[model samples]
Target chain A: MSHFTETEIAYMQEQKLGRLATVDAKGNPHVVPVGFRYNSELDTIDVGGYNMGKSKKFRDAGRHGRAAFVIDDVLLPSQPRGIEIRGRSEAIQQGGKEILQNENVDAEFIRITPTHIISWGIDTHPYHPSSRKISS
Target chain B: MSHFTETEIAYMQEQKLGRLATVDAKGNPHVVPVGFRYNSELDTIDVGGYNMGKSKKFRDAGRHGRAAFVIDDVLLPSQPRGIEIRGRSEAIQQGGKEILQNENVDAEFIRITPTHIISWGIDTHPYHPSSRKISS
Candidate 1:
């Protein structure tokens, strides 16, 4: 069961930006800002505005066909809640009018269908707000 | 040749944390927070505190090794500089002493060997810092 349901996906769609991470051939990690859209019907997410081989990172994704996306800090540290979506890539043309339709982006689009969805809340004993007094 | 150098790697390692992106089985994108350390000698980076199989997303990494790590919110936006490490993950167990030493964490460690490295920045054409300037 996922902590985030269709309702949660709709809520996150409002905040379109998140941190994206990918690795090049040398095992180094590359991260950047990306704009995303949640397709509630497909239960899928699409990310647009990526340039072709703009960096080795994107090139690696083109070559390897996998990447990770994270959205954090929106939830409190003690009760951090976020989503992780993992998937492969298929490169389409970057000049299409459909790609440019997104008001929040500047590059082409890549759609992701998560095979595994991991969503968790910090339920650690100490950080529970009810367990700790804020003012004191 | 890449723009990121040893000094920048050192600077990034000293920072508290970074965002990491990984792929799920269905080629969906997942992003999360990852605290990592850079190994200068082998030119590799290490990320601990992430568990595979224990969580669905991390388990997805086992099936697909592709990933991206990002650290941002620096002084610059268009030309923001960050280090990206990309590679595979090797699961290993360290002694209790090595695992329990971190001030805030208590768990095993996972080593990620990056195969590629890159330095990323943006063009400043549209990012005019003075655009919002007010006449005093």
Candidate 2:
């Protein structure tokens, strides 16, 4: 099977907002929405957000490598769908001076290497259970 | 001061999606998009999701009483905004027979009682940092 099932790939392409979650020093969970894209060449998700370099989510990810990225939409009037991925992550500048949409700030990027996938809906029939761990 | 700033309340009303983060037994953080409502009466956020009772998030909340719910939007075209609330949580079937739209399932409800609120970019100016502990 492919890294991402065809349906999952399609869902990611259509959704622009995803929440990247990480843990704090006290182990409290933190979730924040981000603008993201699936980088096909690297086969991983790349996320960038406004003022993200100074955000707590950035510091948390730097300290804690594991994260969960979820992209979901309930606006379709029907079939609320989402794709959830859990993996190790790192806050990286990656490839020199990536800029953000907001002025005067550099791009904040978190690279996720997924270990498992869990999803619901995002299909014609809808709400089928499709969760699996990636076998390296 | 009000528990929710005027700006935070408005943002919650406009957005239909929120990301809920909970910690698993291993302390791995899990985040999922949820359809939620800010119940002004109870001053809590109640969440319902697809097959949520059977989901890990539900179990995580059941075993652990802390969760963070974040709702964000970049729809304004120029700025991205988010509201993050930290609180204790639990999976409850409260008031008996809470129904799920998908049929044959009682509603899987997760309730979040906020202890703190952190937000940025929910105002006219956008990206203004607003973080405060809720006065209990």
Candidate 3:
């Protein structure tokens, strides 16, 4: 099952980049810009990088085992909407696939399986924000 | 002692918004779109909102007490650069001052005091990506 509504998926498809946040061993937060592609069947977002093998964030996720990814757009001065995904993440070198084509990446990936999602705008939900569990 | 270089400050000043990542009590990662103002004197960012006092993110910030804020701009497909701030944070109903001008906000706030910063593409450092303490 897809973890996102079609509306949310379409929005994610349109965005070029998202930011990812993970924690180090001491629980300090770390966030960085990432490019990702959503996999419909597996219900995941695959974030890949060229040097993922040695990246601090990739290592941080190894220890923390959880992450948050966010992407947003400002339709106008006061009209803005975005999505946030809280999920389990693992840095990997294979079983990777492409969703958005980027010439900057190859092979290694951070696989995020959504646990919770919060979204607003884009007509998916009203009253500013909505949250839901991806699954049990 | 400022946490950011002049280049970083300038880059941040040019960006409209950023994403903030915090964790819940259960160590679940949470991220949200946040509009913030960088305080040069205090070397911190004060994030204010209209209903911040009642938002889940605000409550999460209260529980986590730490956060990561990220702002990135992709000049081109391969030229990606941005900033990351790992900091101490607190949600507050008052003592919030404004630095960035926005017609959308008032009242409650979340304050983030940077302990470390990581950056690339903005030329804050000589390396492609650099990490350093807030103070020299």
Candidate 4:
């Protein structure tokens, strides 16, 4: 079974960019906006960017094994909405092209296996629980 | 002198939202999209949200004193642009109304004093340095 609910999947599909946060060995945090996709087969969030292998975030993910990814945008006139995914991340080489599907893109990527998720303002049911802890 | 350059200040003025990354006591990373503005007087990035004081991010900032804030947007079709600021953070009370100008907003906010900055695609001069470490 997919870790993402249908509404969450739909929200991810509509978004094109997410901010990925990783902590370096020194315990300093870093954040950057990147292209990401929901990998159905792996049930993970895959992030790809230019020169992914050389990026600080990639190294941080490999060293720390923890990451947080957020996709959010404000609706007109002050309504903010988005999702926050916090979980385990793996830095993988030769996997970026599969997610990005661009010939010139790098083959390295960061895959996130979500252990917790918090979302708001995108659900059809207004009173639904907005935060969840995933056991997978 | 301001930590932000003229170009960086201008770019920040054009954007309203930023993603803030903070680390918990357990060394886990958390990120969330936030409403932020460049506080000219304080020379800091001020983040405000609903129930700000009760949010985990607020507590995280209070505990860690370190945070990373990134303001970025894709210029459509594939051009990504943004500025990332990493530095000291303080969770302040009764400051949200000052930055947000909303009476209904909680009186809590996070203030960031940037010690490092990185920017790309937002500068008028292409050959200019894209990253800097501030001594302030």
User: What's each prediction's clash count?
Assistant: 46, 3, 0, 1
lDDT of 1 by residue, A2-104 (tens): 3246545655666656665555565444567666666555555666664432544457666667666665444545446565555555444363225435554
Which number leads on DockQ? 4
Candidate 2: the clashing residue pairs are B65-B89, B98-B107, B121-B127
Candidate 2 docking: what grade?
A: high
What is the lDDT, from 0 to 100, of the residue A88 in candidate 4? 98
**Which model scores highest in TM-score?**
4
DockQ scores of all models, one per candidate: 0.31, 0.80, 0.75, 0.89
Candidate 2 ranges beyond 4 A from true positions: A96-108, B96-107
Candidate 4 per-residue lDDT over residues B7-126, each given as its tens digit: 889989989789999999999899988878898887899999778899999999978999999998777665667899999999998769878877766899999999999887787322
Deviation in Å, model 1, residue B37 alpha carbon: 2.2
Categorize the docking of model 4.
high
Q: What C-alpha root-mean-square deviation, in Å, does candidate 4 show against the real structure? A: 2.0
Q: Point out the higher-scoring one by lDDT: 2 or 3.
A: 3
Q: Which stretches of candidate 1 lie over 4 Å from their true place?
A: A1-7, A19-32, A40-43, A50-68, A74-78, A87-107, A122-136, B1-6, B20-31, B40-43, B50-68, B74-79, B95-107, B122-136
Per-model TM against the reference: 0.59, 0.85, 0.89, 0.94
* A84: Cα error in model 1, Å: 1.4
Complex DockQ, candidate 3: 0.75
Give the CA lDDT, 0 to 100, for residue A54 in model 4: 86
Alpha carbon deviation, residue A77, candidate 3 (Å): 4.2
lDDT of 4 at A28: 81
Tens-place lDDT digits, model 3, residues A50-113? 6665788788876788999988878755677888888899877654445445555666678888
Q: Which candidate do you rate higher for lDDT, 2 or 4?
A: 4
Estimate, for each residue in B27-116, the C-alpha lDDT of model 1 and write its tens digit: 545566766666555454555553422544356455576565655554544344455555565534452124324545424444556555
In model 3, what is the error at residue A133, expressed in angstroms?
1.1
